[model samples]
Target: MKILTITGYKGGCGKSVTAIHVATYLSALGDVVLVDSDPNRTSLSWANRGQLPFTVVDERKAMKVVQGRDFIVIDTPARPDSSDLKELAEGCDLLILPTLPDIVSLEPMLQTAHDLGEANYRALLTIVPPKPSREGEAMREELRSNGVPVFSTMIRRTAGFQKAALAGFPIRDLTGRDRMGWLDYDSLGSEILEAIGR
Candidate 1:
């Protein structure tokens, strides 16, 4: 199974959201289980509030739930220490680091990449302002120049995401423009699959 872990040093960077959506995208290929490794239980709470295509279990219960799973998406706790981050990187097939486009968020992300050393990982820019704002692209280019492995697919910030979380549905499962956010993840999912050569 391809195990994917979503982690970040900062909170509110859409780590849990990205984890859920990615798991939803992977479900198309095979059975997927999302392990809520985060102490906050964000993924587990969302699953309890509504229906999810895949299973979501707390880390404590993950061993049993992970059996026969084709994909395992882990939503790790925010602010893991350097040593913990290194361990997390070595343990997962691909480490996904989601961060905002702003400088405050970038520092931790860059540090995370550094702490990961040679581990397989990619940076995903989340909550990117749409249209007139060029922050997302600008930051992406900057990261590339700095030798950071960032995804070309940037996730635009939208209220649709919050709605999805509140309703316990994947962004793709929503109706109308609210579901538009799914497009970003669809592209991201494609990139992730290719990154891992799956």
Candidate 2:
């Protein structure tokens, strides 16, 4: 099974949101389990509320419990130090660091990447404003320039994500205008599958 850890040094950076969306999209391929490692238990709470299709479990059994699954998406806590980052990334196929379009988030992302040594990791831009602005593009350029692999697909800022989280459903499960939030995550899931040759 391939393990994907979604993490960031800062909270409110869309780590859990990205984890839920990616896990939901990947379920189409095979059995996908989400491991909520964060103390906040955001993913687990969402599962309990919505009765999501995939299984949600705590971190204690994450590694062992994922034995037969196709993908194990781990939603980590905020502000893990360099050593903590290394420990969390152990046996991970891909480490995704979700960050907003600002330096406050980017700095820690870069540091975490550096701490991971040669591990396979990518920085994903999330909570990006939909309005046309150079901020998103500039952040991408900065990460690339700093030798950080950034996902081309950026998760745009939308009330849909918050609403979906509150209602205990994936953005894809939402209807009407709120459903538009699925597009970016779909693209991201595809990109990730391609990257890992899944």
Give TM-scores for every candidate, taking all chains together and pairing residue i with residue i: 0.98, 0.94
Best by the TM-score measure? 1
Q: Record all residue pairs in model 2 with backbone atoms less than 3 Å apart, i.e. clashing.
A: none
Instruction: Tell me the tens digit of each residue's lDDT in model 2 across 1-198.
Output: 888999889889899999999999989989999999899999999888885758889989777778899998999998888888888777588889999998777777677778987778888999898876778889999989988888999999899988898889999998998988899999999889976778
User: lDDT, candidate 2, residue 197?
Assistant: 76
lDDT of 2 at 128: 91
User: In candidate 1, how many clashes are counted?
Assistant: 0
Q: Please list the residue runs of candidate 1 whose C-alpha ends up more than 4 Å from where it truly belongs after superposition.
A: none
Q: Kindly give the stretch of ten consecutive residues in candidate 2 with the minimal lDDT sum.
A: 104-113
Candidate 1 matches the true fold with a TM-score of 0.98
Q: Candidate 2, 7: how far from true, in Å?
A: 0.9
